[model samples]
Target: MFRYLILIMILSITLAGCTEQVKVDMQGAGETIPTGSTGIAFDGKDLLVAKEGLIAFIDNIDTATAGSIYGYEGHFYFDRYPITITSKENKPYITGLAWQNTAGNTGFIWASDEANRRILKISPQGDVITRIPLTKIYPEDITFDGEYLWVVDSKRKKIFKLSTEDGSIVSEYLSPVPVPTALAWDGKNLIVGGLKNLNNPAPSPDNVQIIKLDPVSGNVMENVETSRYLTSPAGMVWINGKLWISDRNSGKIVIISDKGEPSTDIRSYKLPAVAPVLKKVEAKEDKNKTAQDVDEAKRAAEEARKAAEEAKKAAEAAKKAFELQQKK
Candidate 1:
């Protein structure tokens, strides 16, 4: 009896070790482009992509309005162009998008509205459900980890933990990278795609690494280097136990395993004839450009330029302050 008990314990330990082991194979994977693919979400059938203000479908890219499989025959069954929400008197500048099944009953697409500093929850059919306001931080990428929403603020260099029910920030932490751009949640780790300072633009050949973090505390766990395959990895998603990342500058969708190994059967697909729908908002001014309007426009441009500089300085100051507090 004693020998049988010892054998069972040994077998259990071996099985547990095998289940937790990960193999990363990013090399040797076939590379493909999804045409300006930024943020990606899979709805078990088709992949949903986030553009400036429009959503595109990975399977049916040609469909102009119907970017999601939920779309009806032709018209976009989900949200349409000219997003109803506006910020700074302009349309919300959408950066990232994610699809979630609420309570396992309703479907919601959460968009990171950088311009407005908020996250918009809309129905697949383009109806506004509610807006979650996140002030001061420029939200770039977002992901859902079962019960909570994790958002990375690019300018602030912080990862915010938000309540899935109301969007209120539960906690925030300084990200390991200075310019964190994308986020993906594996069952066990929070993967962050980031770059060094945006001010120092690195050449394409420069190797970069994505950091994995402790999901609960947002502490750096490890950095996985993508020496050859990923160039400027931006938006990322975990699908079928593999991490799919979109390279902003390269315009390629890269697939890699948890261990950073490329998938063997990597494949690429041709984008449909219809080009991506670019957001074009006509100026609200009258047809004739009056001298006063022209002068006002010039003045406004100058103010914007100065304001941008000031904002950058303020962001840096805030970051330093936060870091000091963390040290304490």
Candidate 2:
């Protein structure tokens, strides 16, 4: 009888293991342009790209707008007029660029000056608004989430929320990635990228390891992956619902299909390398997370699941209300 009970227990354990869900690793694909720049931004009208000391404005591009499969835009064209930024000290090594086309800001951009440890508020037309100095932090890729500037610090492996008015640090969070690279805002959450970890080979959810973060608490959320399509997740920007990312070394800009498109036809573009890189700062090595840290991560994920369900319920309610009104 004892031997029979042991055999049943073993069988049950095997069945339970088989029933456990595994993460589905999915990624997108696209070709890229070797522009060797590591910055991507849209200045209301034109897509602005920058590297070491030169910034280029892409006025027109056969940018992929709609597609289900990853694009092969081998036959595409764009117009670029280079804008040279020269100074007596030295040429600016622009690591990142960000611009949100809002009221009163048409041509202005926020760029990372790696050489001087500063962020420059300038425009494509060669006008300077202000220069915010970073005491120690190295600014990598940057994104304007409508109100505040989100900056990535590669040396510390962290992301910072900075004040656009004065470049003051509002808040900071440890990047989910050990070797953090780029950042982008997807209407609601912040998407951060990193070097491919061959050891893990999968993100929290799965794939090329791009992570999404909570804007308020800086907590990490599930994010999209670049598959094997992207080499370096360098510079990223949200355009027309897709995440446009750059591979720094390969000089290829990779586009990822996101919210603005149907998942049935999701796509991003691989274009000219136009962005620079995320500069590092002097900082201590990263430490490992404790048990408490793991617990907090689990709680954050649970909260995210609840929030998503609530959002879905609200959308359904709104749709039903519209239907009732139509019947009336």
Candidate 3:
């Protein structure tokens, strides 16, 4: 009976090890993008980026608190070159990308082609599943909201919700900003970049913040300040209740928090006040100084009086000499 129980425990331990694959950072040692990578999507722990001329995936990365795209080492890349668009072969300008995690590693990715005016359904193995054409839509960034896809066009200032099956329009609404560069769905609200209010007479880019919108009513929920380091955000994703934004200018990904600065209890802070004992000491010092000043004043008055008497005697002697000279 003891041998049978030992054999069962050994088998269970062996099976558990076989079920999980060990994650190694070296698996993605060569999967890198040179500066122009924009469109970003995640597949479990892996990351997909639209490299300038191709789409690259970096495996075994945790971007939840990761700093930047270049901060990771090692990459295992599979490239799809000269992506076909509008029945023509060219280097596609892929702007926004969304990934739907499906069975095993057989999920699909949706990419917004800005220059070609279309959206593409692609397989993880770089296969083109389908393409949906767009009319007068200059798509900037895209995000997945359950069964629908949300595409933001900064030029048209419109957000479109589309069907994932055939990319048909489901609904549309006005964007909260004049130009929204990127969009992400944080479970409940749609987070968009570029928060300058052009409606105001003087608009500034320093007003750039994270703008949250209601997914259904298209209403502005709130606009929260982001770190000054974030500039020219291209794509964003929400994970672990924090927003991760990809910045184009810095070529890095940053975690953003909507909760502003923490409050402090200023009422508990008291200014240092002078004590009554110190005030009395200062008053005594002043009184002694005043006495010294009076002594100095009396000495100055005596000196002045002596000098005036000497001058009067000299003037009387001069007047008598002038009278003697007139008699001579």
* Candidate that would win on lDDT: 2
State the lDDT of candidate 2 residue by residue for 201-314, as single tens digits: 443223245767766645555656454456667788887778877776445566776532112212221122335455976444332345567889999999999999999999
lDDT tens digits, residues 127-225, model 1?
A: 878887876568888888777788888887888778877787666777776678888887777788877757655645254557677755445666665
In model 1, the Cα lDDT at residue 157 comes to 80
RMSD of each: 28.6, 33.4, 27.4
TM values, all candidates: 0.58, 0.61, 0.59
Task: State the TM-score for model 2.
Answer: 0.61
Where model 1 places Cα greater than 4 Å from the true spot, the runs are 1-34, 60-88, 103-106, 205-207, 227-229, 260-328
Which run of 10 residues does model 2 get worst, by summed lDDT?
A: 261-270
Output the lDDT of residue 146, model 1. 70
Clashing pairs in 3: 28-74, 28-75, 29-74, 29-75, 30-75, 31-75
Give lDDT: candidate 1, residue 137: 69
Report, for every candidate in turn, its global Cα lDDT versus the true structure: 0.66, 0.68, 0.66
